[model samples]
Target: MIKTSLVLFFALLGLNLFAQERPTEDPAITYANTITVEDLTRHLTVLADDEMEGRETGQPGQYKAARYLEEIIKGYGLPGVGPEQTYSQPISFISERWQEIDFVINGSSKRHLWDYYAYPSKNADRAKVMTDEVVFLGYGIESEEYDDYGNQKLEGKTILIMDGEPKDRDGVSYVSGTEEASVWSEDISLKLKAARRHGVETVLILDPNFQRNLSSARKISLDSRMHMGFSEKPADNYSNSIYISSETAKTILGSSYGKVVKARKRIEKKGKPKSVSISVDLALTQQKKVKELLGENMLAYVEGSDPVLKDELLIVTAHYDHIGRRGNSIFNGADDNGSGTSTVLEIAQAFTLAKEAGVGPRRSVLFMLVSGEEKGLLGSEFYVNHPLFPLESTIANINVDMVGRVDEKHAADPNYIYVIGSDRLSTSLHEINEAANEKYTQLALDYTYNAEDDPNRYYYRSDHYNFAERGIPAVFYFNGTHADYHQDTDTVDKINFEKMARIGKLVFYTAWELANRDERIKVDVGVKP
Candidate 1:
C-alpha cells in the first residue's frame, strides 16, 4: 500500500503539473539540483590528503594540487581551455637577498656590516652604490594638481622617503571633503612611479617598518625567485641599493644641510615637495648576478550560450600557490587557499552538473586558479596585464581565498563566510549577490573584513585586487584568519568540510545568478581605498 501510494502521488502530481503547464522556472528544481556535502567532501579529502605534502607552491606538492585540479576538470566531461592538453602556467620572479651591508655618516667614512641587512631592489639587474649621496625626495610623489616633486626632476637618482601616502593638512589619509575612501586614488606607489618616469635608479624606503625589517628584506631578496625568463649571466652591475640609519642619514644630509631635512619634513607634512638645497653622489658596489626561474598563471574559460552575450564573461578566480616549503614541514595550506582551490574545483563540477541538467548559464565563465598570490599578487598581476580575454568585456570577478576555517572572532557561529568588495566597484553585483543569498542557502553572510581598518588587508591581499585595479567589479570570500594562518599547521584535518560545502554553495548560487543575468553589473559605483 505504501508503494502504491507513492506511485499514485507521483502520477497525480505529474498530471497536475501537466495541467498547469508550469515553466521550468521553479525554485524547487534549482535547489534540488545543488551539490551535496558528501559530494564536496570527497573532493576535499583527496586534495587535502597528507600525502600531498601541504601543497606548497613551486614544490612537488603544488604540482600535485595542479594535477588534481586538471584531472577533476577533465573527468567532468568539460573540454580544456588551455593550450592543447595542459592546464599549467609557468611563472617566475627575479628576487634578491642582501648580506653584510653597512655604511657610515658624519663623514667619518665608517662602514658597518650586518647579517642579511639592507634595502633590496626589485630591479631586473644587480646595482652597486658605494658612497652615493642619498637625496631626500620627500614623498617622492608627483601629480598634476599638486606636485610632490617640489619643482625638481629625478633622473638616474636613488631616493629616500617615508613609507605611505602623505596625509591631508589635518594629518588624515584623506581630504576632509573628498570622502572617506578617497585614498585609493592616492597610491604612494604612483608617486614612486612618477620618480621612475624620470629614470630613478633605485628606491630606498625609510619607514619605521622598513627600518625594523631590514634583515627580513635581505633574507627575502636572498631567498627570492625569478618569475619568468632566465639568465645565465652573472648579476654584477654598476648600481646598488642600501640603507643607512636615521642618524647616519642625518649626518649625510647635514652635508647638504638644511635642504634634505627641509624636503623630507615638507614631504611628511603635506606630501608636497618643499625643494632640494643640495646634491649627493650615489655610489653603488655591484653585488651579485641575477638568474631567471619559471612559473605561470593558469586560466580557462567556459564558452557561453547566447551569441550576443557570450563575449561578456564572469570571472571566478583563486590562487593555487602557497609560500612553498619551510624547513622540514610543508605548508599544506589546507586553509590559506587549499580551501579556496577546493571550492573552485567543486564549483566547476556544480556548473557542469547544471549544464547536464540543461540549466547552463547564458554568459561565459572563466575559472582561474592563479599562481604566486602569496608572492605579492604576482600571478594575478600578470593576468590582468596580459589577460586571456579582454578585460573591459569581462563583467566581474569573484575571488576565493582562505575559506576553510571559521574565524575565531565568529567561531561561535560556524556558518559565516567573510565577503569583501561587494559594493565597492559595482552596486549591481552586490545586489545580485544579496538577492541570490536570500533565495538560496540562506547561510549567515558576514562582511567583517569590509572595514577599511580591519587590518587583515583582505581587499589588497588577494587576486581580486587585480580585477578591481582595472575597474572590474569583484568579490572576495574569506573565512577570517586563525592561529595557523601563515604557519605550517594549517592542515587538512582542521578543515570544516560541511561549512566549506555551504560556502561553496553560496558562491555557486551567486555565480549562477550572475551568469544567467541578462546584463552585466556596472562599475560606476567606483572603488574605495
Candidate 2:
C-alpha cells in the first residue's frame, strides 16, 4: 500500500510541474497579429484613393477623410470625447501671407531677398513703422558679466545687433568664458527676449553670412503660414525683426559702420560691452493677406478595465491631411501619412477586440487622427493646448508619420524603421519599445534621426514634438522619405502593405505593454515648450 501511494504522489508532482512550465500565448501578440497586410491595404486604398483630392486640411477632401476615420472608430464602439460625445474637435486657424513689404533706408528702397528679409508680424500695431536714429547694441548680450543696454532707455526704439556673440582669439567665448557659446549666442530667442523686455519696437539682426543663407530664408518667407486663431499671443512674442546683410547694415550705420566693427573686435578681445548710437531715417511697411479656415481632429477613446488606472491615458496619433493638389495633379500622400492613419485605425480595432474579450488595457487609450500636420502640426498643437483630459494625467504619445515606402538609406535592407524622440524624455519608454521590437517584430530600430545634432531635425518636425515640448514622453515612427515624397506619384501601389503591417503590429505591442504595465513609465528627462 505504501509503494502504490508513493508512485501516485510522484506522478502527481510531475504533472503539476509540467502544467507550471507550459507556455501560453500572450493575448497581446494574438490581437497584434490581427493587424494584417490585407486590413492595412484595404484602409490605405480608401485613404490614398484619387477621389480624396489629396486630403488637404480645411478642404473638402480633408473633411471627407475625417468623416471616414470617425465612422471607423465609431463602428469599433470606442467612446468619443467632448460635449455630446462627438468624435470631431473643431479648430480654427488664420492663414497669413506677406502681400508686400517695403523697407526704405535713407529714402532708398531695398530689395527684399538681396538686401533684406522680414517675416510678417501678427502683433504689430500698424502696417507701417518709421523711426529715426537706430541704436546699435553690440552682440545683444545681457548678463551680469556684460550689459549692453547700460541704463539707456530703449523703449519704443529700433536696435541693431550682430548675429553671433564675441569670441576670443583661442576660440573661447567672452560671454561664457569657455569654448562653447552661451545661450545668448546659440539661441536667437534670448536676444529677442531682451529686446522685448526693454520694450523695443523693432530689432535688426546683422548677419554677415546673410547672403549665404538667403535662399533658404527666402523660400520660408514666401510661403504662407498658419497660426491658431483662438489662442492668445505668446508672452515671448517678438516678431518685428528684420535680418539684414552687411551692406544694408552699412547703409543704416553710415560712417558708424567701421566703429561698430571695431567695437565688436574690442569686445571679443577685452570682454567689454559697447553701445553705439547711429542716426538714420528708416521706414518699414508690411502688408499681409489673411484668410480664416476650420479643420477637424478625430478622437476615439477606449476606456480601461482597471477603474483607477483608467484615468491615466496613452495617446496614439497620426495626421490624416496631406498637401493639396496642384492644378490637376493630386498629391496622394499614401506613404506620407495614409499608412500611418491606417495603422492607427487597425491598432484601435485590435484594442477594441481586446476590450470585447475582457483583456483590455489597464489605462485608457486615445486614438487620434489629426489634420494640418502638413501645414505645421497645428492639429496636435490645438489638442495639447485644449485637452479634453488633463495634460498631467496623459502618460505618453505614440505618433506615426510616413511608414509605408522605404528610403534610399535602407534600400539594401528595407526591413527597418526610424524611431525618433524615444529617449528624449523617458529612458523607460525607449526600453519598452526596444523590448517589444526585439520580442515580436525583429525590425531594425534606427535611431539615426534621434541625434540632437541631426540635420534633418526629424524629432521636431512631426506632431510628436508638440507633446514632447510640454514634457510628455513621445515616440515617432517613420519609414523615412522616398523619391515619391510629397509627389503625386505617392500612390497606393507604391506602398509595402506587408512592411506597414509589421510596423503597425510593433506599435500595437509597444502600446499594449505601456498600457498594461503595473506602474507608469518615469519621465527621467524633461523639456521646455
Candidate 3:
C-alpha cells in the first residue's frame, strides 16, 4: 500500500512538472526599429537648456520639466501607468532647513551655516549631544581580526579617525577582516550605525579629505534632508558628528597619541602605534531655524505586449533635479542629469513609437526621473521605499547619469561611452549588455569602475546602486568624469550632442533588446565584491 501511494505521488509530481514546462509565448518586441537621434536631441535641448535653471529639485523649474516630460510622453501614445489618468507616481518626502548650528574648537567658534555644513540625518528626531569625552581612534576602524583599538574601550566616547580605508591606487583596502572596512555607500545613517557597532557615540572624522575629499559636515547636512525611515538600521544610541582640521586634532590628541598630522619621515619608519585616547567636550548651539529644504521623484510606465511577460517589468531611470539656487550663482545641472532625464524622454518616445507600430516591448518599462540626487540620491531612495511597481516583478534597471559630455580620455574620439556596474551583479546582464553593444551602437564600453578595488566605488554611488541593493540587475551609463564634473561650468554648450546621441542610441538599443529578449536577464546569486 505504501509503494502504491509513493508511485501515485511521483506520477502526480511529474505531471505537474510537465505542465510547468509548457511554452506560453514567444519573446516580446515593442518598437518598430525606428528611433532616431534627431528626436532625442529635441528633448535634450529643452531639458538640458540653462533656461530650466538646472532643474533643481522642488524648484518651479523642475516642476516645469516634469510637466514637459508628461506632455511629451502623452504625445508618444502609450497607455497611462496608473488607473486614473496621467503617468505620475508622487513620492512624499520632508525637507528641513538647518537654520542654526554652532561649533567651537580651541576657543574658536563658528556657525555650521557658514563655517561648517550639516546634511540632514535619517533619524526619528532631534539627535543632540552636549559636552562628551572624545577619543582618537585611528580610522575608527574595527575588525574582529585586528582591532585598531586593540581591546581598548571606546564606549561613550567621541572618535577621531581618518577618512577612508587604507588602500593603493587600486581600490584594494588590503585590510583583512570585513569588520574594519564595512563602511557602506549609503547616507550618513549607515556611518552612525557603524559608530554604534564600534561602541562609540559622537564621531569626529579628522581626515580633512576623506571619501572624495568631501566636507564631513556638508555631507552629513545633505544626508539629513532625506526622507525619514530610509535606513534599514537606524542611528541607535549614536549621534552628533563633526570634522576638525588636522591642526585641531593635533591639539586634541597631541600628548598620549602623538601629533595628529604625520610627517613624511614617519612613512619611512614603522607606522605609528594603533591606539590613542582623547577627552572631548563639544557644545553644539542651536540657532533660529528657518525654511524646509527637499525635493521629488517622477515615475511613469509603459505596459508590455505579452500577457505572461507583462507580469515582469523593466526600469529605466535618471536623476532630473539638480542643486537649487544656492547663492547669486545657480548650479546648473545640465550635463549632470538634465541630459539624463531628457534622454529618458527620448527613449520613451521611441518605445511609444514602436508600440504604435505594433511592436511594443514584451516586458513593461517604468521611466523614472528622480530628484535630490545632488543632495545625495534622495529621490531614488524615496522610490525604493515606496515603489509604484512591485520590486519582485522588476527584472532590471538601466540608469543614465551623465552621458552628455565627452570624457577626458575620449575627448577626441567622441564616440565612446562609460559603462559601470552592468557586470558587477549579473553575469547574464553582462552578457546581454555585451551582445547588445555588439549588435547595436558600437561605442567603446569603458569599465574604469570595474576593478573590485576601485577607489571611486561607482557601483554604489549612482541611482543604480539603489536598485542593485534590491538584487535587481542594473547598469550606470556615464561619459566618465571631466574637467567640469560637479562644477558650475558643466553647460549644455560644452556637451557633445553627437556623442550624447550615440550614447543615448546605445541605451535605447540595450533597453529595446532587454525588453524584447526571450528570457529575462538572469540574476547572479552568490557574487560579492
In the range 422-462, model 3's lDDT, one tens digit per residue, is 88678878777787778766778888886668898877888
Model 2 per-residue lDDT tens digits across residues 1-529: 9999999999999998985455235889878978999989989999999888999998889988888888888899877787779998898786555687889998999998889886554334347889988988888778887778778899889999988887779998877878987888777777877888888888899988897889887775676756676422323566467899988999999988888888877887888888788989999877766666679899988999999999999999999999979999999899889999999999999999888888888999999999989988989999999888888999999999999998999889878999999999999999999999999999999999999999999999999999999889999999988789999999999998889999999999999999999999989986732
The Cα local distance difference test for each model comes to 0.68, 0.87, 0.66
Which regions of candidate 2 deviate over 4 angstroms? 1-24, 95-225, 230-289
lDDT for model 3: 0.66
Q: TM-scores, in order shown?
A: 0.61, 0.62, 0.58
lDDT tens string, model 1, 1-529?
A: 9999999999999998885455347532353345566765676666666667766556676677777777777787776665564565566656444443334332244343332134344333443444354566655555554455654655666767555555666656522333242432445445445666666665555544545766665455566555433332222331233444565455556657666666656655754566453455534443544443345555555677778887888889888777767677767677878788878877876676666656676788888888778868877887777677789889999999988888778878897888899888888888887887788667777887787787877888899998998899999999888999888888878988878877887888888888887777777785675
RMSD of each: 14.0, 14.2, 18.0
Model 1, C-alpha of 3: deviation from truth (Å): 10
Give stretches of model 1 more than 4 Å off: 1-33, 82-85, 95-288, 291-293
Query: Candidate 2: lDDT over CA atoms?
Result: 0.87
Positional deviation of residue 161's Cα in model 2 after best superposition, in angstroms? 44
